[model samples]
Structure formats: C-alpha cells, structure tokens
Target chain A: MRFDKDSLWYPGIGFAVAGLLLAFGQRALNRYSQGMQRSALWVEHTYDVIRTIESLSSAVSRASANRRAYQITGEPSYILEHRHSAADAHSALAALRDLTRDSAFQQKNVLRLEDLVGARLSVMDDLLKAQARGGLDPRKSASLMARARTLDTRIHGLLTSMTRYEEGVLQLRAEEGQIGYRRTRILQYALTMASGLIILVILLRLSKEIADRQKKELDLRNSTVLMEVVIEGSSDSVFVKDAESRYLMMNTSGAKMIGRPLDGIIGKTDSELFSPETFARLKASDQEIIQSGRPKVYEYSVALPAGTKTFQSSKAPYRDPQGKIVGVIGIARDVTAQKAAEEKLQEAAQIKADFAAMVSHELRTPLTAIKLVIDMIVDRTLGPVNEEQNSALVTAQRSIDRLSRLINETLDFQKLESGKMEFRVSEADVNRLVQEVVISFEPVAKGRSITLLTNVAKDLPKVRCDKDKITQVVTNLLSNALKFTAGPITVSTAMDGSDVRVSVKDSGPGVSPEDQTRLFQSFVQLEGTRSIQGGTGLGLAISKKIIERHDGKIGIQSKVGDGATFFFTLPVDRSA
Target chain B: MSPKRRILIADDDPDILAMLSLRLLKAGYDVVKAAEGSLVLALVRETKPDLVILDYFLPNVKGDEICLQIKADSALRAIPVILLSASTAALPPETVHAIPTDDRLTKPFDISILLEKIRLLLPAESAG
Candidate 1:
C-alpha cells in the first residue's frame, strides 16, 4: 500500500479512471437496453401483421382460380372452393387486427388488408352462385375472376410492405445487440487480464522474498558450521558454562587439562577436578572476575604426580547477550622448564660462595707457619745463626711463598667461575715469556738433574694477550714437569693457524686415561701427582680457563709411564 | 749477666725452632729444642727445661697430647707450656685449658706478639 511518489505512472489513478469509465459504459448499455425492449415489441407486432396479410392474399388467389375453373367446366366443385376461401379470409382478418392493436401505422395497413380480403370473398361467392345457376354466363364469371385477381394483387402488395418494415426494425435491434455483446466481452477480457497481472505481481514479490529469506538462512547455517569447526579443531582448550555455573561444553584440551576423559567434565565443578586447596583458590579467582566483569590473569604453582610445575593462567568473565556475567573461562600453560633454570642458577651461586669460604680456611694454616718464622728472624730473636740456618730460613720462605701462590691460584679459579676474572691485554713477546718461565724452573730441574731445554721458532710473532697470565701458564707447566721428573723438561713454541702454541714436556709417569678426563677439573689430581708432589690441583684448570678467555685452547698429550706434554695456544697479533 | 732459663720447645718447622730458641736465649732464657711433638714430653722429663713451647699439628704426637701428658706428670706439670697452632680461632676455651698449655699463639703472629704471649706464659722473674 506504500508507494514511492516519484514514479512516472500513478497506477492508482489509472485504475480509478478505468473503473469509472467501465461504470459509465455499463450505465449507458443498461439505458440502451431499456429502449431496445420497446423497439423489440414494435418489431414483433409488425412481424405478426405481415404474417396475417400473406395468409389472406393466398386465400383470395385460390378462390379466384376455383371460380374461373368451375364456370368453364360447368362443375359444382367450384362451390366448395368458394366456401373454404371465405372462412380462411375471415379468420386471417381477425388475427391481423389483434397484432396491430398497439401500432397505429401497422394497424392501418392491417385494416386495409382485412377490408380487401372481405370484398374478395364476397365477389367469389357471388361468382360461385352464378355458376351454379347454369346459365351460359362466361363473361360474367370472367369479370368476377378479374375482380378477385385485383383484390389478390392489392393484398399481396400490402403484405410485402409490412414484411419490409418489420425486417428494418429487426435489423436495427440486431445491430444494438452486437454492440452490447462486444462491450460485455471486452469488459470481461479486461477484468480477466487485470486479475492475471495482479496475481503475477503477487507471485513475483513472494518468490523474491522467499529467495532473500533462503539466502539469509543459508548464511546463518554456514556461519554456524564455521563456528563449530573452529571450536572442535583448535589446539587450545575451549569450554563454556551456563549461567548457573555448570559445565555446559568442553573441548579436548580442556578435558586433558582437567586430567579427565573427554566430555567427562560436563556437569562437574572446579572442585571435582582440583585439590581442595587449589579448588578454593580457583573458585575465589573465578568469583573475582565474575563480580568485577573484567578479566583476571595470574600464574599458579602446583605439585602434580610428575613433579612441581608452574602454570600461567588467564581468566575472563563469560557474559550473556544482556551482558550479565555468567561464569568464567581460563587457559593455562606449563612453565616448569623456566622455573627449573632459575633454581639451577640459585644453586650455582650458593656453590661459588661455599667454595670461597673453603679456600680461605685451607690457606690460613700455611700462611701461619711462614709468618711465625719470618717474624722470629726479623726480630733477630735467634741469638746466633750459622750459614746453614740462614739457608734453611730462605728455603722456609720459599715454601711459604709457594703456599701463597697456591692460595692465589685457588682464588683466581674461583673468580673465573664467578665471572670476576679481569684480563689486561697488551702486545707481548711470546718467545721471551716462555723463556723466562723455563729459567725460573732451571733450579728445580737441576735438583732433579733434569735438562731444561727450549725451542723457539725463528721470528716468532708477538702475541696480543695477557703477558703475565701467559707467563704464569708456562711456569705452572714447567714447575709440574720439574717436580715430577728426573730426566728432562722441554719448552717449545710454534705458529699454527694465526695462533702461537707453547708446549712444556716432561719425562715422568704420564696421566692415566681415567685421570686425563678429570685433569683440568679443579681439585682433581692425577694418579701419581698427589704422592709425588703436593698440588692444589687447580693449576691446569686455571691455565685452561685463561687460554680459553683469550679465544685459544689448551690440551694435554700423555701415555701411562711415558712423558706428558702440556700445551696452550695464544692468538698472534690478533684479538678475538 | 745471669744464665738464661732453659726453655724446651717442640715444633715441626726448623726455622721456628731455631729462631725461637735463639731469641729466647738472647732474651736471657736458656732455650732447648725438640723438633717433634713426640720429643716434647721426653724433653720435658729429661732436659727438664724451665718452660715448653709446643707446636700443634706435628708429625707424631699432636701438641695438645704433649701438653696434656706434660701437665699430668707430677714432676713436669709445674713447667709452663705454651701451645702454638694455625687454628687458634677454632679451639674452644675449655679445650684450650684442658691441656696444660698456659697460653695459645696463633701462627703468622708478629715477633713482638709472640714475645708478649711467651712472657705471659712464663713466670715474671724468668721472663725478665
């Protein structure tokens, strides 16, 4: 019923005009039909008059013929003919008078015809009587026949005129009837076409509406299928709960998280899946989020059957269409590995601290002996001293110095592990550093009657490294060799792959395979090391760390009962 | 000058034994030496030095054992015994006195500190 007025055609106006035109046309047709009724009656009366006149003419003509024949033949049959003709003429005259009663023009014609028929009948009777008299009167009979013929002709003319008038009236009525039929048929056809058009329009609108509805329904179905796929196919656990806080849905991961069979968590509370203490905490957190209508995220640590583990959890309030908080949702991730690394770091820190304390305690005893003797000598407390005593004092001082060196090395190793060792790098002569170390061990080699030898590659490059630390490395190796061997200790240097290599060799019982593996470990002693010579067992370990810090390497080569050679490499004129 | 009071000392360090004996003798006390803790009790009985200085952690007998043995003997118990150890901090007061050592001297002590400690252990007249 609502229309857009900007349209070109006003269909409502067109329909109203067509309806008015049809009403006017129908009224005109009804009025014309009323007039036609009167016309029909006139035509019917005219037709009746015409039929009467024709019958009267035929009767007169027959009477005239019989009269003539009877006269000529001198027979009595003529008399019968005259009688029949008179009766027929009289009845036809009555009928014609009745038909023309309502039509004055037609009535005049009918009365004239009736008069003619009567005169004719009288003439015929006269003629017949004369014939019966049997007097030879041929002329009289013929004259009478002529009179009859004239009367017949006059009647025929009147009848023919009446028929012509009635036919004209009937032709006018038929033309009006044709016009009415055409108008009625056209109206019927127009009504049928309009109704069909309306029906077609209705069907088209309904089909379009159905198509739109089907499209919307199909979209809704597709989205519903997509949502189902997302929920079912996700790797993370997904779940939902009703307003009453009962488990309404759960995905596979959610089921595993609760440590239950798939779909077993339905209708179960958090309390059923967790320990009582954990359940209480979870419920409290859930309530907090639900009440605040905001998401709350946190992490929790739990002791499972496997081990203690940490879980990062996030929770948010589930809401209804009206935005009323219904329940809560959460996702959790295990963080056990991250927590284990933190614990390991703490344990390492504690070990370093304990090592520092042990080293301090172990070093005090040796320092005490050295200081007591030195104090006595400095104080000149000894009344007299022989050359041998003085020499012994120097030896005691040297032993104490060795003890201090061991303590310093232990401290240095501890510092390296704690990432506190500081390296001061400078350009230094690698050859000279190695030579000085060998000279310092010369006395020890002499005491054991071992030859101390060196091999320096010609034009050896200067190394960019900590000179003092490298010298300490060479000295430590030489000292170990001199302490254990009776034959010879050799120092050698070479250049290989952008680095200078320093090696110290000894003729002594070499390290066992078992001891070699632990040779560079702090506090580790080889098979013969502890019994043959006293060592803190940290020299090789410390030297290895220093070389590695210089971006080089240290290694050992030895066989049981054969001599051992220890070597280290330093970068030459290059820093790494 | 009066003769030095003879002091018998037992220590593993030859430097300490020679040094302390010389110093004590120069201080006007006769000094005797026993280089081993095992010899301290023997020196106390035989040499009968006026005082004994015992070093802890010797090769044979510990200094405290010698101290206890010397104090337990009725004849030698009268001689003052001074104990020297690197771990003087570890010794409990009761354990220190459980031995007959009159005083304790931790190692690396200055010559003056050792002298003061020795003087405290000895009788005033003999220390002078």
Candidate 2:
C-alpha cells in the first residue's frame, strides 16, 4: 500500500511500529537471556559449591583423623595431612565465593561455609596439640574429634543449601526464557502473516479497480466510436480542433466537405488546409469562440474541389472540468440547394419585372401610333369616309379592341408572375358584378351577332373581394367564351357552400380533355377549330392566379359539341 | 416675321430622333439633333436652343450628368431640357427638372401629354 502521511497506512508509521516491536522483542529476549545467563552462572557456582563442600567434608574428616594420629604418636604424616586438608579447604572456599558474585544467599552461605572450615581447622589444631602432649588419652581425643566433626557437618550443610538455592534460580530463569522465546515466535509469525494478508488484499483490490477502470475506458471508446459514426453520416460537417487550432479530428463528411482526405486534414491547421482569406476568417472565429466561450454561427461561401459551396457554420469552444477552454468544436451544414432556390426565385422575379417593363414599352409604342391614327380617322383628319369605309372602320375598331385585351392579359400575367399583383378588397354585390361584366361583352357579342345572356341570382351573396379585379376576371372568362364560341354565351352566378360561383357557358367546340389539363398554364393555347382571333394565351393563366390570390378557385368543363363552361368561385361575405 | 423657335432633341435611338424631328418640323420649329453622349454639350454650346429634349439613357454620358453639366453652365442653363426614357429608372424628376429643364417626360408618352409639356415649357404665343 502506498503511504498516507496522516493515515496509519503511512509507510514510516508502519515501519516505526515494526521497529518498536522488534526492539521491544529483542530487548525482552535480551533481558530474558541475561536473566537465564545470570541464573546459569549461579547454578554452575552452586554445583561447584556442592563439589567443593563434598571435598571440604572429605578434607575435614581426613584432617580430624590425622590430628588424632598426630596427638597420639607425634608422626610427621599427620602434620602433612593436616596441612594438605587445610590448603584444599581454603581453595574450595575461595572458588565458591567467586561464583557467588550476584547471589547474596550463595555468597553468605559461602562465607558461612568458609567460617566453619576455619573453625574446623582450628579445632583440628587443638586436637593435634593434645595428641602431641598427652599421647593417646581417650577423654581428650573424644573432645577434639567431637568439636571438628560438628564444624565439618555445619559447613557441609551450609554449602548444600547454597547449591540448592542456585538451582531454584536456574529453573526459574529457564522457564522465563521459554516463555520469552514462544512470545517472540508468535509475534513474528503474526506480523509476517498480517503483512502478507494486507499486501494480498491490496493487490486484489488494486487489480479489480484496474479492471473496472479499463471497462470504463472501453465504454468511453465505444461512445467515441458511436459519435464518430454519427458525425460521419450526418449531412453536416463536424470537426474538433486542439487549443493550438490544429485539427485533432474530423468526420468523413467534414473532410469530404472541405475537399480534403481525412489523413490530410487530421493534423493540419486552417492556414495549412484552407486558403489565406478563409484561414484568416476561421482563425478570427476560433479566437472569438476561445475568448468568449460562446458559440458563433455564420454563413460562408467557399470554393472547393467539388464546386462552390455555401455553408451555415456554427463553432463552439470545448471546455473541461475546470471550465478551461480546451479546444473548438464546429459543425457546418451545406446550403447549396437552398441558396440556389433563393437565387432562382430572385431571378424569376426580376425577369418578371423586366418583362412587364418591356411589354409596356414595346406594346404601347405601336398601340399609341395606332390609337393616334384611329383618333385622326375618327376626327375626320384623314378625310371624310364613305359608308363602306365607315363599316371597315368598325372592323378596325374590333381588331384594336382585341389588341387592347391581349395587352391587358400580358400585363396581368406579368403582374402575377412577379407576385406584384395588389388586390383591393371590398364588399361587392355578386349579381350586379356579374351583370356588369356580362354587359361589357354585349357590344362584342352583338357585333358578332351571338346571343349573350346573364342568369345572375337575385339573392346571390355579396362577395368580399377586389370588385374591379373580380370584374376583370369575369370579363376575361366571358370574352374567352365569345372569342371561342360561334353561337351564344350564357353568364350565370350561383351560391356554392361558402363561395359564390360564376360560370360563363358558351355554345362552341369545347376545349379537349388533354388541353383542359394544361389550359391555365401560361402561353398554352389549345390547338382547336376555334379561331384565336389574335389572342395572347395568358388570359386563363392570369385569371387563375387572380382567383388563387383571393383564396378562390377556377375550373372549366366542356364536351366537344355541348359547349364549354368556365367557372370560378369566391368566398361569400362572412363579415356581414 | 417672328424667328423660328429653336429646339434641341437628344436621344440614343436614331429612330426616336427622326420621328421627333418630323413631328417638331411639322410643328414649325427649328430642330437641332445629337445622337451621341459627347456631341450633346458641344451642340448645346454652339446652338443655344430655346428647348432641349434629352433621353435619360445614353451611350457614353449619363443623362443626369449631362443635365447637371448643362445646368451648371451659366450660358446654356436657361434653356428648358426635357428628359425622356423608356423606364423611369429611378431618376429623380425634381432634380432633373430642377436642372433648368422645364420638364421630364417618360417614353411611350402620350403625344397629347408631350404636346402639353412642350406648350407648357414655352410662352403661350411663342409655342405656335
């Protein structure tokens, strides 16, 4: 285990405890050994005392015998034996005293033994003098022998007691040493076993922790893989950069969108991977995100290997636990389709405006001259006309009328296409509006000698719409019918649900089923037996656009000989 | 007899100049014409006309710039300049008309409006 300074697991603290226990055990063992050594020394001293006491006992007996002999016969052998016994006793007493240095009882017993030996020697001397002087007197010999023998018995008993006391100390010292040894063994075994178990437990826990950490790492890797897959398959380009603005990673879509291979872009900076202008722009954006820690979204057009592309790009800073801005994450969406669509719409609008201007300039020039000529003729500035000439003038007037209608249709088409048509909404009487539109056609229908009729309901609901534009719409439908039909045209108005329906039915060869489908498309004139009468093919298309703008609908139904019916519906007055 | 009234007609289109020339001639006025941008001012300096009809769109010189130049000059600025074009083209009417030009006319203009503009630009008896 690693060391913690304040924890018990601290290496130094553990070492200190171990060292203390070792020192304590060693000191205990040393103390026990020292006691045992002292006891053994005493036991050896006592054993020497027992040996010396036995020798002393033998020496005293010998000396007593020799003194009796010397007292009876005055022989030199008795004196020599007395001297040798005395020397031997003194030497034994000295040796016993040296071994008894730490034991007071043994030393005291040695001293007592020594005193007894001396007394015995002194008593032997007295016995020897008595033997020398009185030569074998029974009474004197008995007295001296009694005194020496008593001293000898006392010394021998004292030495035996001292030896037995040393033996007792030795037995106690041996038992204490055995206990110390067992305690040390148990302590050492326990310390070793605990250390092993602690190490084993630590190792097992560390391995399990390592495995768990590895599993978490593996899961993080899989999540990264999933993120990469999503980025690669997305329509948007996704990329990450390090703090230094070098590419750390980029998805396949990002690489492809940037017109670079993944390997090429992986470690490159914007300066290295993009143009100078683009690089500067990107660097500025990166700095902003890094500085403010906010996301930036902007559109940029880039010329790449594929082609020019426009992208809506968003970039944000990636932060870590400390809220430090570590890197940048960016996503860019390709907007080429939307961009192209917008451009097309603008171009179409401009073209429509241009066409309107062109029509006004081009058509009005000729019409103005024709109108001037017609005005002059009508004012008799050209000359007086005959009856036939006047009749021809009427025909010319009709042709001019048709030309004016065509011009109006072209203008309407231009307005509709440019989305510039402005409708003036108002409450209009539907029946009156229909009758007014049909009345405008009465002159043309009478000129053609075609019967024109109106079937407007008296109770028809008033429609909320632009009256003039709606009247123009009805007139256009009626005029188309008059131009296409030969016989008669019936103008009718009715109520249909929330709408007011107006229909112009003409008795003529009707529009074909195929042509009917494309009838309202601009510039689509049906190929039929009916004469176009110099018509611009924009009337139906303009009418349809006008109706649609009012939130209404226009439709047509026809059979070959049963005549064609052009119908339109406008919403009834809900405000009323 | 009174002197014929002098009129300067400036246009990029030659056909418009010819048509205008015939009309102005029929109206009994002396017509001086210039078709290019560079020639208009030189002609104006030479012939100080009573009236000038200028086309808004020109090949080399902008109509507004020409109007400014004409108006800026002390000698020729008094002549009435009528500007005409197929499209309004966002040329300010007041500014062009304020350049000592009595009128501004858009092309495909009604002949009656044109006659009225011309008559209005001249003194009542002098227009005849």
Best TM-score among the predictions, by candidate number: 2
DockQ of each: 0.18, 0.11
User: What CA RMSD would candidate 1 show?
Assistant: 17.8
TM per candidate comes to 0.37, 0.47
lDDT of 1 by residue, B1-128 (tens): 54556778787867667666766767777777888767777777888887787787677898888887878899987888777764433344456556756877655455577677777766656333
- Please give the C-alpha DockQ score of model 1: 0.18
Clashing residue pairs for model 1: A381-B23, A383-B22, B4-B30, B5-B29, B5-B30, B6-B30
Q: Rate the local accuracy (lDDT) of all candidates.
A: 0.73, 0.76
lDDT of model number 1: 0.73
After TM-score superposition, what is the CA distance of residue A159 in candidate 1 from its true location, in Å? 64
* Candidate 1, A253-301: lDDT as tens digits: 6676556886568988766766787767767777788888888777777
lDDT of 2 by residue, A1-576 (tens): 332345335444555666665666567667656766876775676567667667766776777777667656778987998889778878867876776766787777777777888888887777666655755477766877787667766776775676567667667766876786688667766766665565566666667766887788899999999887788788788889988789988888888788888999998898997778888888888888999999989788877778888898899998888989999999988998999999998998777677676766566556545644554465455569778877787677667666766666676677676676666678889888888877777887888999998888768767789887888889878878877888889999988887999999998888778888999988877765335565577878888998988889999999877889999998775442
Chain B TM-score in each of the candidates: 0.82, 0.85
Real contacts retained, model 1: 0.43
